[model samples]
Every structure is written in C-alpha cells, then in structure tokens.
Target: MRVVMSVQIKKNASIFEMTREATPKEIDDCKLVYCGHGFFDEADIQNNINKNLMD
Candidate 1:
C-alpha cells in the first residue's frame, strides 16, 4: 500500500508540524526542510518540480 505524509510550518513558529505515513521508507527519508532545516512537505517538492518543468 502507498501512504502519504505532510509537513507544515506556522507563521512566527520555530517548530514544525509533521504527519507520519504508513510507509517506513517514507518516514525514514522524510526531512524537515528542503535543505534539512525548518518544515517542508513532500507534495510541495513534487509541485515545485512540476512548476519548474512547465515554465
């Protein structure tokens, strides 16, 4: 089965909110931010790539 996860940041907040998925690999590979800090979402990464390719 495939699972989805999410990471979110709140305005004026230092800590991030993370949601875990059912996949162990996904959880292990998940990082806080794009560069390894702050909050980031996997979906956002894919979206960014798609946007860049379309441009």
Candidate 2:
C-alpha cells in the first residue's frame, strides 16, 4: 500500500512533502520512509496570485 503525506514549514516559506509506497508496518517505523518524486502543489499559489494582481 502507498500513502501520500505533506508537511508544511512556515518559517522557511516552503513545504516538505513526499509520498511513500510501502506496507502498513513500514509506515509505522517513522524512519524507514522513501522520498517521493515530483513537486507538490504550493498552498499559497492562489493567495500569491491574488495578492500580486491586487497590487
């Protein structure tokens, strides 16, 4: 089984996100996780666009 997870870091203005395709038990370890590929959607995309347009 595989699961997708997202982590957001407010201070850096960035998000630490990834996906892991592993068994149920493997996910519980908290350390035996694989880094997923590709970039996830930014949470502030719409907000930024709106702000820029308004400015």
Candidate 3:
C-alpha cells in the first residue's frame, strides 16, 4: 500500500503574505485568494499565459 499526498490550500492562507507582492484583485480581497486548487480554469489559462509571455 502506498500513501499519496494531496495538495489543498483551504481558507485563510498566509503563504502570500510572506511574499513581497500585494494581493491581486483577482482573488477576492486576498482572504480567499489561493486554495491550492486550480490557479486558473481551463478557459482562462491560455489568455493568462499569452498576456504574461506577449505583454
């Protein structure tokens, strides 16, 4: 039997606070920002990548 690790960020994460960047507007006031699940949905993934790379 093997045990697997599951990644989840749950409510109230402090990881971002340690970083320099202020909470982005996209994540609902930074409180519920990262839940460790799906940074972006399938639809917006391409757009975000393009914007970051192109612009």
Each model's lDDT = 0.40, 0.47, 0.38
What are the per-residue Cα lDDT tens digits for candidate 2 across 1-55?
3354766645424333445455667557654333334444444654553454454
Which should have the higher lDDT, number 2 or number 3? 2
Give the winner by TM-score: 1 or 2: 1
Write model 3 residue lDDT over 5-34, tens digit each, in one string: 333342432222222233465355644333
Question: After superposing candidate 3, which stretches have Cα over 4 Å from the reference?
Answer: 1-41
lDDT of 1 by residue, 1-55 (tens): 3233443343432223344323566446653232232344566655654454454
Best candidate (score: lDDT): 2
Could you say which candidate leads in TM-score?
Answer: 1
Pairs with steric clashes in candidate 3 = none
Superior by TM-score: candidate 1 or candidate 3: 1
- Model 3, residue 12: C-alpha shift (Å): 34
lDDT sort, best first: 2, 1, 3
Model 2 compared with the native: what TM-score? Answer: 0.23
